[model samples]
Every structure is written in structure tokens, then in C-alpha cells.
Target: MKLLSPKLLLLPMLCWVQQAAAQQTTEALSDVQKIEYASPGVRGMGKPRGIVVEYERLPQFDIDSKSDDPEIGNGSARVRRHNKFSVRALAPIMNKPQTKLILGIDHSFEEFNFENVTPATYSLYNSLEDKNLKSVGLQLAFLHSPNEVNFYLVRAKAELNGDYTRDNINISDYLKTTIDVAYGWKRSPDFAWGIGFQLGYTFGRQRVYPGILYNRTFNDKWGVESIFPANARLRLNVSEKTLLYTGYRIEGASYNLLASNPPLSKFNDIELRRTDFKGLVRLEQEIYDFLWFAVEGGFRQYYRHRVFDDVGSRDYIIKNDLAGAGYIGVEIFAVPPRRFTEGRKNK
Candidate 1:
């Protein structure tokens, strides 16, 4: 199968599963029943209810030099160390017996550096580095559950991303968007599975990437959490207030470029495509009911990093080797308040 074929095939399955599972949930809950609280210490979207800030220290990494463009004249490939930061806020906008709504915003910032550039290409490389990389996005999500065992999810986001160095920034040209829809089934108190596809435009192309979301606990001590083609983790419960995880994830983004300096300015605006695979180990500790801290370190393996001209032609490649890095972050969240119907008690 091709890179995106599986994702296309899974779209239909998502809808089918949503309807079937919801039917089962409705039948199972035919009689009036009280609410059931989720298992303690379950890490999920529902667990983090308010604000999150994450920062990672990216270490220097060696790059495998290969570019079709001869003007670059590269001797060696290396990416200078940099810092990455992101802040996210999520809040419940609406809550009802069978439907829910959430609104969120995620913003990120990073700077880029390419090491060991030949003097001949100095002006070009400097122009690229002078541009600051940033992305800001707003997210709207909806959830529908016929009963406790099954639910449907729909999330949409619009993002503004680019190197903000231009005098006349065309905000419309830099906009990026994504949509994800899925159905989930909770087979047991400790196990759940979901199927869905995330559709978006990246690297100057449109793609439909399908994935499976899953969470399963083998026992009190071991478990797995994963969304295939994106991330997967094996988790260990250390204590009531602590947890450990080892996992790998696929990460990447496409940024609009501004080649404003002389000589390189002839190339016009470019598109920088970056993708990486990371294997990591992380520790999470709770400080209080509303606060938590985490630290993680891992290897970053560059999978794809390339530059494309405005006409959608490949211009350069930034092949990089494996590098080690660390990250520390904090989160402040609220315990979700119980929902009540307008005219009747929740039961």
C-alpha cells in the first residue's frame, strides 16, 4: 500500500464503528443509571483541562549532505542547537448529556540554523536564518456520545504559519488547516480504541493520513497508548502521583519561507518541509491537584527535511543524523466539573 492509501480506506470504517458502538451503548443504558467516573490516573485529553506549556532543548545534530541544487555548495551537514516552545489552552465551551464542545488555541515558536555552509552560499543561508519561524492556530472540537461506551469526535483547526519578516505579509497565503473525525469504543474500563484520519496540506501538498487510536492496560503496572502512524507508548505506573513512558512519534511541519536577501532573493518565497522520528523516555509527576511537571530526553532522527520553490519544485535537502535532546515542561489543569441537564439531575 502507498503512504496514504491505508488512511483513505479507514475513513469509512470510522463512521461504521461510530454508529455500531453508539447503538450498543444506547441499548446497554436503556434503564436510568448514574454516572461512572473514569479510572484514576488515566492520562488523556480529558485529564488536562486548562493550560499547558512545553519546551524542548534540541541538540546539535549531524546532517547527511545531499542536494540537487549545485549553488548550495555544501561541505558538511549539521543543524545547530535550538529551543522549541509551545503553549496550549483548552476549555469546555458546552456540555450536555449527549454532546460536548471544546475550544482551544496552540502556539509554537522555533528558530532554524544550518551548520558548515560554504562561504559561496553565505548570503543565501544567512537570509534563511534571519527569518523567525512561528505558528499560531485555533481549534474547535465536538464530541457526541449516545451512551458511556461509545462516542464520535470531530476536530478542526486553522493555522497561520510562516517566517514573519516580510513587509507585506499575505496572511491568506500562509494559512494551513486540518480536520480530524473519528469514532471510539471503550471495550473495558482499561481499554479503548478509535479509528480516524487526519486530513491536511503539508510540504506543499495535500495528504490524508489514517490512524488508529488505542489505549490498553495489561495490568495495574503496564499499559499501552497509541495513535498509529503518529505515536505509540508503553507506560509504567510508578505511583499514584508519578508515571513513566517510553515511546516514538512522527513529527513534522511545512513553513512558508521568505528569501529576502540579495542573490537568494531571486528564488522567491520557498517552502521548508521538515519531518522527524523520535524515540523518547519521559517522566511525569504531579505537584498538586492543579499543577504538574514533566521531564523527558530522547533521540531525534531526521527523516525528511527539504526546501521547495514556490512553483512546487524541490530545491534543497537537509539530511540530518541522529541527535540526543531533553525537554522539561509544566501543566496547570482543572478537574472537570460534573455536567447537569437544564431541567433534571444527572443520573
Candidate 2:
């Protein structure tokens, strides 16, 4: 008797084993009550139950600055760095069926430094100055997940930032608020996908220089959000703490001078717009019962365009093509169960 081919013989066994293992894992997880405090800021099914905090550092590089303009000098040869830190807490508001209210605060600081070349020719008076920015924000979210089919999340957030500073001059100050809602479709225990929409509005002021005062204003009123400064994010979960996130954001602003009438024309009004396509991959490892460490890297492409009416006749539009930025950061997570736990533990 001839023996059956090895490929045919092994295929059915592999399928059977896989199916059995999946079923077993599912049953085991079902017995385990869904943890309410998994991720501190965001709520989801099978998330960790506790408060968590994290800190991160990200560095960005612009690759296209090399060939764009010869007269415009290249500032930095190395990567530009941006630092970020965040803290979050989650609590079980009502549990019997497992419901959670998540509260979080995140603070981020960013500084963009440019390389100095041709110090004599491109002096501080002529070269573009470096910038430092700081932002602080709060987030509140409600999460509900009843089985795989019924899952929903809602979040509201507010952010405020001080004026961006360059060469000791204040550039802008901004405030923004955002709201989001999402629904999920979970095909299995290991895989889930979601779609969400975010709407936001920003109010800000821009400063004008002394020489440009006749042409520009000291402060310009501006508002932007989803339509002009908006974003959509797509999220995928690889495990309980690890996630893969990618998204697109568009931001724009227009400015007008105060002294001019029909501000749009006399002010040499201008609107600047940028679109960013970004992706991030993160891994979370628990350091202790309440502490975790996360490492993440992000890749981004930036597109910028500016439209302004020239001092003379016609309008001028300029576009900066795609530029690349890459960043890597590590975060430390700390969560204490109760407010008094810190004092009690020391004793």
C-alpha cells in the first residue's frame, strides 16, 4: 500500500489543533472577569484593571530639507527631538456587569532646534529661529462592551498651550476642545478593529513683527478643527497592551492684520495648511503590579502649503512637498490603587 503524501496528511491535523486551541483559550478567558482598570485612559474589553501613567521622548527628522532651496540654508543635519509625558487613571464606577469611567491628564513639551551653519552669513537676524512649545490637556471617557458585537466608547477632551517661543519672541497661544465616539467589531479574542470620528475647535492668536506691523497684525483671531485642523484614526490591537495605530491629520490657519480695512486684502492675509500621515507601533511590558514600561516609534510625512496675497499685484501660493519624520520614545507607567496607599506602603 502506498503512503499518503505528507502535505495532505499534515494539513487536517494542523487545522484541528488550531481550532481546538482557540476554543480552549476562549473558554478560559470567559471565566476571567473583564478587568476594568487595564488601560488608564481608554476603556476596552479584556483591559487591565488599575491606574497607569507614562512618559515618552520622540525625535523627528526632516529629510527633504536637503534639496529644496539652495539659498535657504540647511539648518540641522541630525534628528530633531520632541519630548512627551503623560499620566492616566481608570476606575470602576459601577461593577456587576463591568462598567468604567476613565480620567486622564497628558502633558507634552516640544522643542525644534535647527543646525547652525554659515554663522556669519546666516546670522540670528536672518536665519529662522528655533521654537519651544508646551501643551497640557485632560481627557474623560466612558466605555461599554457587552460581548463582541456590542461595544462603544465616548471621549471628551480639552487642551491649552502657552505661546510658542522663538528667539525670545512669543509666536502664538492656543486652546482647543475635542469630542470622539467609536464602535468596535471583534472577530475573536486576539483580534479587534474599530472606526472613530473626532471633532475639535481651536482658538488662537498670532503675533506680527515690528517691521511687518504695517502688513500684518500683532494678534489675529483664528479657529480651526475637523474641517481645517481635524484628524481620523484607525486602531488595531495585537494583544492586551500592545497596539498599532495609524492616522491622518490636517491643520490650517489664516491670519489678518488689524490696521487694514477688508483685512483679507490689505493685511496680505495668509492661510497655512499641513497634512500629516503617521503610524506608530507600541509594546507594553509590566514592570511591577502597578507599574509598566512602554516603548514606541512613529513615522510621519508632512505636507505644507501657504497662500498669501503679495505686497504688489497677485496672490502667491507655495507648497512644500512631503517631508519625513521618525521618532522613538520610552514611557514609565505608575499607578497607585488608592490615594493613601503611598503613605501606608512607606510605613
Candidate 3:
């Protein structure tokens, strides 16, 4: 009986060791897959989204613009609606154990509807309401890992953003370029972190900023994913098929408008600068294998929404501080198949 007692005590310890080994194996597999398939939005935080369609809308808000020059009009207007829709696709062109290359393309359309202009003197309002702003972007990214723990990523994206009008049709005038570079340490399957720098125009003007990436899985039910100054979210795993996130995101862009629009013709190329800050709650649910649906809603605030002729001269035409409003967004996205995420593990 004494000998049997020792054996019984060891049984639980052996089972615990086996469970730990299994969890480590699963986490290591996730890391291996991330090396091959880095996500487009937040690098290796979560599953790579292959195809995505999204829409966002804002409610009514009051906005008034002031200009130094009276010809451009100092006026107040009520914005009835603001809507945006976007589509994105990502594909891995080259995949290897130590290196990966991905290609992505995205397109967006934005519309603004205005009513009740106090002084119907601004001609630009007609152009703004009638013409939808559009953006087409092309991105290429490369990831390399010299060994199992350390990796670096480089990405470049080019965007053509503007209202499609005969006067604003010049491609060169509408092009905007951005670049991102980072160095990461995949310390374990459950955690990763990195630091980098970004050259982009998320503030409605071209600026350089530091970037930080942190991805941590605390347990099966809770985690965090963040890329600072862009987005940060607290993740909740409600179930295998459902996830919830609460976080904030920064969104902004520069768009080219009609050079022929009135008083601005004396200036150089016309550009509209816009930025939004939002604190949101997002819910993602799997409808079936590989297909998912996401819905998010939040309050939107304007950081800066203005018009400028040439940033070099620093002459601003119209400056606006619109009232805050609630906004909602929905998405339909697809993830990789079992063959890409599962079968590779056995091999």
C-alpha cells in the first residue's frame, strides 16, 4: 500500500505535465502560422483576414467653417449624413519558413450630405455633396525571420485619393505614399511585442511617428492586441465562434478636390484634410467555418477637418470643428482555410 501511494501521487503530476506540453504545442503552432500569414491591419495579432467588406455611417451634426478670406465664405451648415464603404483583399505571393511577401489592395468611397446652409454662398458645398470621395490603395509587405524568435517587417502603400472630377483627374496630384517598418520578438506563442516607426498622413498631414505592437494572450478567454496611435483593443473570447473587443482607433486621410473650385484657383492644388477619433465596441461572430461577421459602434470626434491649398505655404482656407456624433460600422470577412492553418502543423 505504501508503494501504491507514491505511484498514485505521481499520476496527477504526469497529467499536468502532459496538459502543459499540449498548450505549448498549440501556441508554437500559432506562431509558425503567423510567420507565413501576417495580418494586414495589425501584423501578427490575430487571424489574417483574407477578404473584407465594411461600411460606416455617422448621424446628423452641426458644422460651421471660417475662412480668412470672405470670398471663400464664413458659413454654418448642417450635415445630414456621412457614410463610408470599403473593401479590401490580401494574398500571400511568396511563403516560406523564414520569409513571406504579401500583396494587398483596398478601395473606399465616402459621401457627405449637407442641408440648411445659413449663407448659401459657398460653391464648394455643391461639389462636396455631389461628388463622392474615393480612394484606391495598393500595398506590398515583406516579413523576414533570421531565426525562430526575431523578425522584421517592411511595408509600403500607395494611395490615390480624391473626388473624381475632370479638373481633379490628374493621378499624380492625388497620390499619397506611406511606409512602415518594425522589428519584433516572437517570445512565445502567447505573447509578442515590437517597436517601429511610421511615415504616414493619418493626421491629415504627412508626419512621422513611432509605432508599438503588443499582442498578449492572458488565457483562453482574455487577451490584448494593440498598435499604438492607430488602434488598441481589449479582446474577449466569449466562445470558440464569438469574440468581443473594446478599443479606440484613429482614422484620417487627405483628399484632393477640384482645383477649379472658385477662390481656391489662385492657390495651388486643393486638398481636404480630415481626421476622426473613435472609441468603439466591436463584436465578431463566426457564421460558419472561415466566414465571419463583425459589428462595431462608437462615438466619433473630429481632430481636424480643414482645407488647405499648399501645406508648404501654410495658408488654410476653411477650418471646421464639427460636433461629436455616434457612428456604427459593420463588416463581413473571411479567414484562411483549415488546410492553411491546420494541415501544415502535421507536416
Candidate 4:
């Protein structure tokens, strides 16, 4: 056989080399020590010492709507409001000299309201309903930071949530679980950064009503489906208290009916998938031994894909593009009285 072109023959090898190099870089960078400056507090404990309370509020407006059909509606005015409050309690689960455990709980609520001025058509319509979504999660983290050889953090979290509508409609209910592990180099105390990996799974059900008229008309034949979801987050730390985070998330689900389904269309069965990319920058300042404050801002982009099945024939139906609103929020931290005293005594 004639020899393959040099470029084509080298393409696969080059790709493999690049991937291996990236993996090696991540592993090599994971163990570098962060620089720490002299401060008036404890120096060695990598654990959150006290209870911290954080509150965030983001009010935003959007000028674009996902619907592309100009007659149905081109642009829509929308507002989103989000609030989060969390309480973190830190204590030594195992009092061994080198290992520590921390626990935290966070509760948040987000609401979306869309107003479509575009004249309604037979093919497209606006719901004019507000969407309110809520999420609550708990986390348990274990940390091991000793001298300068190895630093590791392992954490697990679980979250539950309801649908995002205000029309007395329950679209979906979901539960998510995540586990993350990170290894960092022990160098200094002031600045440190590391690459980490996260794995998550989501289980949920999307409820579809029959004809949108009866409240109790549950369609067993059109029941919701379960899905396996996975996402990843990149973690960066500028200081012990400040963090920068970025992540990509995706959720796959199926719906038996489209939002614009006609009254008599039994062929409304559809499957939906959503993907999102988000970035966040946050700064934390310690106000006192027991209290801290934080500010954060971020943006998100989302994509939605729909597939439909009609009369024993399946086809790609619609693709919607949405740009997520940006948000800024503030957080406050509260430490237990004893932890405060301990820090003060150390200082």
C-alpha cells in the first residue's frame, strides 16, 4: 500500500501527545504550594473555623427570547431574581493531628418571569406564567494538609429541587449528588491554586399533564423518564478565602408534550436536552475572627435541543438558543463563639 500522507499519519499521534501533556501538566501543577503571608490568625488549619452565613441577590433583565419564529415572537422582556443563604458549621470530626472534617448546608431560590409582547399565533404562544425554582444542598468535606508533601480534599454534596413555574404547575422534581476530590501542593499560605475533578449524577422526573386541563389526570403511558447527568467544575483559589470557579453542566430529559402542542395532537411526544456553561469570580474578606463577607458575579450560556416523534416517524423538531442573565451577590460569614475565641487566643 502507498504510504499515507505525513500530515494524516501524524494527526492521531499529535492528538494523543497533546492529551497526555495536558494530563501531565494538571498532575504536576496540583502539588505546588500556595504562598501565604504573615497574618494575625491561625496559620496551619485549612478548615473553616466558624459558622458562615452568606446571602446573595441577583436581579437581571433580558432583551432576547429563545423563539426564532418572528411572527410568533422575536424578542421578549424578562426578569430574573435569585437569592441564596447558607450556614456552615465547622468542627473536628476526627481530632487526629493531621485530618479534619467540615460540614455545610445551603438553601437558594431562583425565579424567572417572561413577558412576551409578540402577538400570539396558532403555532406559538406565551405562557405568561412566572417560574420559581428552589434548591437546597448539604455538603461534607474532609481535608488533610500536613507539612509540605501532600494536600487533599474530598467532598460530597446532595441537592433537591422543584420546577420553575408559578402557574401551580409542577413541571419536574430532581435530586442530584456530586463528589469531588482535589490534590494540592503545600508551598506557602497566601496564594494557592490547583486543578480538580468533579463527578455528579442527577435523577428526576418531568411530569406531563393530559391536555393541560385536569390537575389529577396523570398519564401513565406518557410518564416522565429518568436520566444520568454528569458535569465538571474547575477550581482556582487566589487566597485562602477567595475563589474563582468555572463549570460546564448538562441535563437530559424527555417530555411527552411540547409547550405549544395543540389540543388534539397526540403526536406531541418530545425529548429535550439542555446544556450550560457558567463562570464565576468571587472575593471574600474577613471582617473579624468570626465574620466574613463576600461578593460574586457570573454569566451563563444555555442551549436547548428538542426531538419529536410523530406517527411512528421520529425527527429533529426545534433548537432554541438562550443567553443566561448575569448576576452579582453578597455573602456573610458567622463563626461560632468558641471558634472566634480560639482564633483570638492564637493571635
Candidate 5:
């Protein structure tokens, strides 16, 4: 089954099962409703996920660092350790057959620890040691089915990413926002397509781009899900309890960082823009009634890593070219009870 559209892809669980089970007493859904949120009796979307959490500690990787200023002189850079943590939850604000409103929240934190054997070099590298980045986001997803065959998907998200502590946090300096709206058609229970415009920082900066969301289920064992230009995955249903996926994903972000010590003492703050493109494989297995665990491994290619003045007083100050590195992550999430979904299917 397909996940959320590209705009709302940050939270990829499709749990409308309880809603589907409750809808058994209601009339048939229009074409859009069936495709956007599949009926339980149909073999379309999968899972009734509620909460998801992920953690990863990427290994030490070599990095080649350069700067717009040659006088700062540097030798090499290495990321000694990188730790990432994230969590997300989704709940229905309003659920109906014709219209659905879902609210989701996501929080993420990351730490980059640089290996510094000798401190006699570049100022930028000195300041980059032990840097931290954080983000908290809110998203509202709206699925509207006006008629039988047509549907619309609208999603908006606002995030704050930065290095500021609780004492000095400023909303105006760290807020980043995005919006995605697409028009889709339900050709059948197992196929759907849509096109939409996305305005956000998917490439480490602000830009507007068009995307095509295509989902197809070939059989009980095979499926494909994608939002073009951002993500795509091939799905394999090995059994009722296990699932596998191999796909591509792009991650991008801009963080406002504090300027405390040397090197950046002149500026109030600096901005870090980064993007990563990866191809990966994932395996998901049920752990208990509603608990599931997943393991993912991938090779990440750095697309952009740049630094600039936050006040827009100057052009980019630094650019680093990072080599591709292999990465791995693990996750645990909650899905609806099997009894509830099975019950809906037998209806």
C-alpha cells in the first residue's frame, strides 16, 4: 500500500483502520476516499500506525573541508561521531468518509562531533566541534473527496531548526515552513496518481518544485510507492508479519547556529545548509500485538553542505564536499491491533 503524499511524507504511517472499521455501518466511499484512505476490506493501504520513533549513530566518516577564504588554512576534517534521534505522532482531528483532517507532530535532534587532534588550524573547524541541531514541527493533512473519482491532498508543515538553547530561542530566527497540495484520481482500488507543487526546503534551501505521486500494487507480494523527485520505494510483502522495502530518499535542512567564541564572533549567528541523497533497504517485522521494529541500511551521498551569514550581510562563507558514506538506522512504531483490522476485513 502507498504512504502519505510527498508533501506529508515525513510521517509515513497509514492507520485509518479504526476509521475504516467504524465506517462499516456507513455508505460506500467515493473513489477519492477509497484511494486516499483505503477501505479495510480492500487490499490497498497497509498498517494502522500511530506513533513512530527512530535513532541512529552514524560511524566516523572522512570529510574534505574547504573555505571561501584561503587564509584560514585547513588540513582535513573527520566526523568522529554523529547521533540522530526523532519521534512523530499522528492523530485524527476530524474523521469522516468524505473529508479527513489529520494532525501530526515531529521532533528531531542531531549532534555532530568532530575529531580534533590539534587545535592550531582553521577557525571554522574549531567552531564546528560538538555542534548540535534541533527541529520541532507541526503538520496538518487534509484529504477531501468532492466526487467519486477525484480527490485533493493538502498538507502544510512548520518547523524550527537551530542550535539555540531554551534560554535564547527565537521563533523568528529559526522557523521554516512548507506546503504541498496535489490533485489525484482513483482509477481502481490498487492504483492512484497525482501531481502537485511543493514549496519547502527539501534541497537544503527554499525552492518550489513539481512532483508526481504514483502508487501501484501489482499483486499480494509486490507493490511500488513514490513521490517523484523526493522519494520512491519498492515494497515486498514477504508475509503477513514481515515487510521489506528498498528505495531512495532525499533529506535537506537549514539550521541557524549561534556564534559564541572565535572565528564567528563578528556575526550574530550563522546558517548551515545541508542535503543528503540516499538509496537504502529496510526490513520491518512485528514485535508484539501493536509494536513493530525496523532496520534500515543505506549509502548516503552528500549533495550540499554550505555555511552562510544569517543576517544576509555576505555570500556563503564556507563549502564542504563530503564523500558518500554508508549509514544505518533502526525504528520502532505502533500499528493498529491485528484483531481490529482482521475484523474489518471480514465485514
Candidate 6:
């Protein structure tokens, strides 16, 4: 039990989208009508403008036996599921309207299973049953506005994580890098805000964080979208082809394992950090004009499932439970023609 708590229904939808953006503005507002009333296009609820393919499943995800590893002679550790598949692409390669450039590619696949173990967890699923996790990512985006209410964003990303079955693939030892910048303000026609700083280099140190983003639109059926520590949502517009959301997200990954065997063969390389915290409910429809269909359900809170010993730094823990999951997705996108950003409408 104990579920419901999407920040308590997102604080009354963020106080009604900040009092409906301060009662529908008062002068000075343009920047393309304040970025179209601070987001409600690209199919509302943000994130739309190119490619994406998603798949997720968490069948069971249970494995709680609390072990400080005394050869796990009992207690628990069965884990029979947990899978994911993803593919994403975002491309715009510069399409001016006050500066814009984008290019992105991401790939992911995570699998975990035990098939029903027990021999004291069989040495932790026989060292993850021939490990070979995957991750590939790359992104570059820059968008500038300078007018229409100010906007600026810059991003750079790269990630190549993990266990390619037994080592022997060193793209600089499985890289991970990120850089981001932000500065946006629409502050009128329905609010908007941004601030940023994100520079990272995972698992081997180097980090710098600080971020905030916002979007609001209280009319057309409620709204609020955020990206702080990374994720937030509360949008409900069951019309214009449906939509509904209630969110929370925080997912992590950092893999690169295969230190030979037996408790990580004295260590030289082995790192598997996984984190999760989700509580969601999503729904989106729209079945034409570029297609869309989504359905989600969740509650899989298990922050961290560790394993580290990059040459004896020492760390181990494998089961952090609490699970539930379901999702279905399909999206084919490309938007921006409501008479070219909402104009000519008379017939």
C-alpha cells in the first residue's frame, strides 16, 4: 500500500499555474506570444519536436533480502524481471527563428533477471548472468531567442556506458559527460522561467549541479511542467485528443562491470550504480497527424543498487526493493504549423 503522493497532486497544480500567470499578463509580452503561452504546443505537456521510440517493462522487480554479504545463505534475492529499451532522436540542425540547432541520439537497454534463483541467490545470479548492459548517447543543442521574451540554452552530452560481456571496449573507459546552460524568461503570457548549470563526469568524480526550469499555463485545462532535479508534471487536458499526467521521475544508471568473477575478481573495474524513484500515471492519445499514444503506470522506488570496487574502493549492495511498472508508448512527431504558429484562422 501507501501510494498516492505526486507531491500531493502537485501543490494544487502549482497554485493554479501561478494564478493563471498572474491573471493573464499586463502589458509587455511578445517573443512569439511568450513562447506560445509558455508551452502548450508541440502537443502540450512539453517534449515534442522530432523522434522517439520507447519501451519499458518491470515485470516483477523484487529482491529484498538485506545482506551485508555473508555468502547470502538465505533471506531473499530472486529478481525475475526488469527490462527496458529505448531509442531517441531529435534533429533540427539549425532552423532559425532567432537561432536554433539541435541534434540528438540516445540508446538504452537494461535487463536484469534471475529466473528463480536460490542457492543463496546463486552468487548473485551468477555474476549477472553474463553481463552486457548498454548505453549510447550523444546530444548537442543550442537555442537562442534574444527577443520574444528572452531564451538561451546550450547543451552537450555524451555517454557510453558499460558491460560489454567481459570487457574489451574502451571508448575512453566508458565515458559519461554532460554540460548544460540555460537562461529563459517569458514571465508573461502564462509564465516561464529557467536557470542552469550542469556539468558532470560520472563515477570518477567531477560534478557541478544547479538547475531549474518551469512552464505554466493554467487555462486550456490546467498545466505545469518542471525540470528541477529532473522531472515533474501535472497536466490534465482531456480534450484536444486527450492527455493526463501526474508525475515524478529520477532514474539513474552507471554501468561498467566485469572484474572477472568471484566477488569481482579482486577488483580492477566494476561499477554498477542504479537508482530509481518513480511514481507516475500518464496518458496521451492523439492518433493521427504524426501519431501519438502513451500509457503509463508506476511506483518503483528503490534508490540505488550498488556495486563498486574500481580497484578496491570497496562497495557492494544489490537489492533495494519496492516495485510496480507498466508503460506503452508510440510517438512520431514534428509539429509547428498551426497556420505556422497560430495565425491565419478565418475561413
Q: Per-residue lDDT tens digits of candidate 2, residues 215-311?
A: 0111222111111123333444454434443444333222221112222234433332223444565555556645667676677555442323331
TM-score of each: 0.78, 0.48, 0.85, 0.50, 0.86, 0.32
* 2 against 4, candidate with superior TM-score: 4
Error of 1 at 282 (Å): 1.0
> Model 2: which ten-residue window has the lowest total lDDT?
209-218
- Model 5, 210-272: lDDT tens digits are 777677778999887777777888889898778899999877777777867556656678877
Q: Which stretches of candidate 4 lie over 4 Å from their true place?
A: 1-60, 63-77, 80-92, 117-128, 145-147, 164-173, 190-195, 201-289, 297-320, 323-326, 336-347
Candidate 6 residues 1-347, lDDT tens each? 11111111112122222322232222233665533323111124432445556666666555654446654433345566655666666655765545656677767666666655555435545666535477777767666555657666767777777765333777777776667666767766556777766664222233565657777768888877765665677888878667798987655556666655455455567666655567788887766654566777766666555565561245554444444454333344443333432332121
User: TM-score of model 6 relative to the true fold?
Assistant: 0.32
Best by TM-score: 5
* Model 5: residue 318 alpha-carbon error in angstroms: 0.5
User: Clash number for every model?
Assistant: 0, 6, 0, 12, 1, 1
Considering TM-score, which of the candidate structures 2 and 3 is the better prediction for this target?
3
What is the per-residue lDDT of model 3 for residues 38-132, given as tens digits with 9 covering 90 to 100? Answer: 22122123455678888888889998888888778787888898888888787668766556677878888788888997677465566577467
Q: Give the Cα lDDT of each candidate.
A: 0.57, 0.36, 0.67, 0.37, 0.67, 0.55
lDDT of 2: 0.36
- Evaluated against the true structure, the overall lDDT of model 1 is 0.57
- The total number of steric clashes, by the backbone 3 Å criterion, in model 6 comes to 1
Q: Give per-residue CA lDDT, model 4, range 118-156, as digits (tens).
A: 333223223213333344567676655554434555666
Q: Each prediction's Cα RMSD?
A: 6.7, 18.1, 13.0, 17.2, 4.9, 16.0
Candidates 2 and 3 compared: the better one by lDDT is 3
Q: Which residue pairs come into collision in candidate 3?
A: none
TM-score of 4: 0.50
Better of 2 and 4 by lDDT: 4
